[model samples]
Target: MEDQVELKRVFGDVYFRARRDQNTSIVYAHWYGSQAVETVKAGGYKFLEMIKEKPYRKLLNSNEHVIGSWDLALEWAQNEWAPQMRKAGLRYLAYVVPTTIYASMTMEMLIQRIDDEFEIRNKEADAEAWLLR
Candidate 1:
């Protein structure tokens, strides 16, 4: 919690928080509820911006509270967001899968589409540990 930067925006449906520990930094994004494609896109852009400015090597995206499909945003995420984040020095990604079957499935779909090295788990602690290791 030493180098924590709260990246949450007032209007956005997603909550973001960026934290750094030694050489690695993590941008944590948790979906609030059902979100629109534009909302997802906006969150991605904000995430990229933060990592670029801070240069985080790890990203933790939690979809635990998501209630609807973000499948529409998957294409942009795989094609654009992932690549851009990698270019910005993102090497590890930890995704916290949603508890609901539908949301978890959708989140997994995006994970498979991404070319980056990442791990999917049900707990944020596990994700953090993986990112650190």
Candidate 2:
């Protein structure tokens, strides 16, 4: 499998990438970064939808997977992307990256809110294990 990681800033959302199989793409947002959290808070669903509809859509056709960084964002992602993507035969997986000690607790909280949330099988390891599968 061919993999690529790119750092991109879209509408002020600074995120990193971990792409596997070209079609299967994951956008790992920088959680502790200066602008990103604020950008998401400010942009809300509008920003997420734009990201989903444009950049994510380009990579994710039928039978592709797109992963995002935050659970709140994932909630937005599920509501915004899942139905359309599923109809097209694509799957969406949303998992949180524990960038800080605080974020690990945050992930736990978010996991409680959603049913059947995708948790990293091994929180201590890299996401590649889960993403590649």
Candidate 3:
């Protein structure tokens, strides 16, 4: 994050924090733990609102520390968030999948179903590289 500029961290009901990297014009969200779909949506909507503060085109979302099944969020992610984000000028998304098996499966399914542009990576550095590239 050496070259990155920060937006004040935003928190939500779910275990996650979001900030903007002005250098890359990307919204970076780090999600943790298992959460109810409603809580997840709360955080997701917060993320969407953050991007609206600026015309960012890329997102680097890391699920590396996640352990809970968020399978329920898949539908909203694909149907609601993806479409809304695309309409908001988001052109690229670099999703860092969780290392834990169950969470990874859910996230993989989510990335698979999302209609908008996305590139999945195993690590944040890889995701950043992909986003920056």
Candidate 4:
């Protein structure tokens, strides 16, 4: 199937895009500023809504551009979002880790708690390769 850009949602400092290609759906996130709890929750809602509409086994989540720690958001994601997303047919999530130590740490923590296949890479290309594989 041809790649189609499905849901594109922006809330505060975060931008979410879901694009479908064949059996894969890439969920891209470009975030600015600190990821507040409300903004993170809104973004998570949009993400879940889009993924449920089109079940995708593969996902690429780019977070390299995020500048600050989203520790609280990470907790919410691990406890709330991850389980729901996994149930929505998300099998593998390839993530491009952020540059800051705190952001990276939070991402690591979230990754550890999730049951689905999760990979963290330093580059977007690497993340995409993992997702495609």
Candidate 5:
């Protein structure tokens, strides 16, 4: 949520910026624009890379500006990303669910596949609170 970005992933004009919240020691990412299967995979890689750099147990993933469903990436996200998050010592995830129906559904699918402590919130503030708590 701060301007202290550590890394960024760009797909066209969309920007996925990640930073470590010094206040809470949580790695968080916020992005804008639409998502496809490829973008989802790429974002997953970027998230993993960021989290793996530190022993961060919590993540705040925001999809508030994301415009499309990432349903096509569900298989890879479930089979690969989920397991890797656990391997990287990630224990808690606070996902800010998008407002769109399909995008929210996609988030639900991904959340259900995760085998760790996680929460989905409609607002970033709520997500951050849950992550910090």
Candidate 6:
């Protein structure tokens, strides 16, 4: 019998369970839970491999911003995952969670980082219209 995978929601993100179809030699990430954050932080090389093992894609459907521990998340996403995905021809839309000035280095640094990595958009209307454009 073929194995079946399930999707779970955690902390507002949907994740998939990890599954392998031996006949097709394909691996799938079919589970998403709160543990995903930790899993990613703990060097989820297997997960990265799984994403590369097959044709996979992602669509960002939210406007949420990264809040607490934004730096850690940024470090992981940029230094670890983005390059691999780009090489694999995979695309992603991330709702970059916004952080307050106190939590981040500076407005210039944040903008430069986001511009260099991801497609960023403003979640709210305000004075910083230039940033979104």
User: For residues 52-130, could you state the per-residue lDDT of candidate 2 as single tens digits?
Assistant: 4434422211111223334455454445444444444333344544545544554555445442433323233534445
Candidate 1 least-lDDT 10 residues: 1-10
Per-residue alpha-carbon lDDT of candidate 1 for residues 10-60, written as tens digits (9 for 90 to 100)? 664335444555554566666667756777777777777777777777777
lDDT of candidate 5 over 79-124, digit per residue (tens): 8987887788787888888888888898888877764434444455
lDDT per residue as tens, model 6, 1-133: 1243334344545444445445533333422222335544443454456556654443221212223333445565666666665566444322323344433342234445545544444343431232222
Off by over 4 Å in 4: 1-18, 22-24, 115-125
Error of 4 at 40 (Å): 1.5
- Report the C-alpha displacement of residue 60, candidate 6, in angstroms: 2.1
Global CA lDDT computed for model 3? 0.74
Q: Which ten contiguous residues of candidate 4 have the minimum total lDDT?
A: 1-10
| lDDT for predicted candidate 1 compared with the true structure | 0.70
Question: What TM-score does prediction 6 earn?
Answer: 0.39
TM-score of candidate 4 against the unseen true structure: 0.75
Q: Evaluate model 5: give its TM-score.
A: 0.82
- C-alpha RMSD between model 5 and the true structure: 3.4
How many clashing residue pairs are found in candidate 2?
A: 0
lDDT of 4 at 80: 83
Selected candidate, larger lDDT, 1 vs 3? 3
TM-scores for every candidate against the unseen true structure = 0.78, 0.41, 0.82, 0.75, 0.82, 0.39
Pitting candidate 3 against candidate 4, the one with the higher TM-score is 3
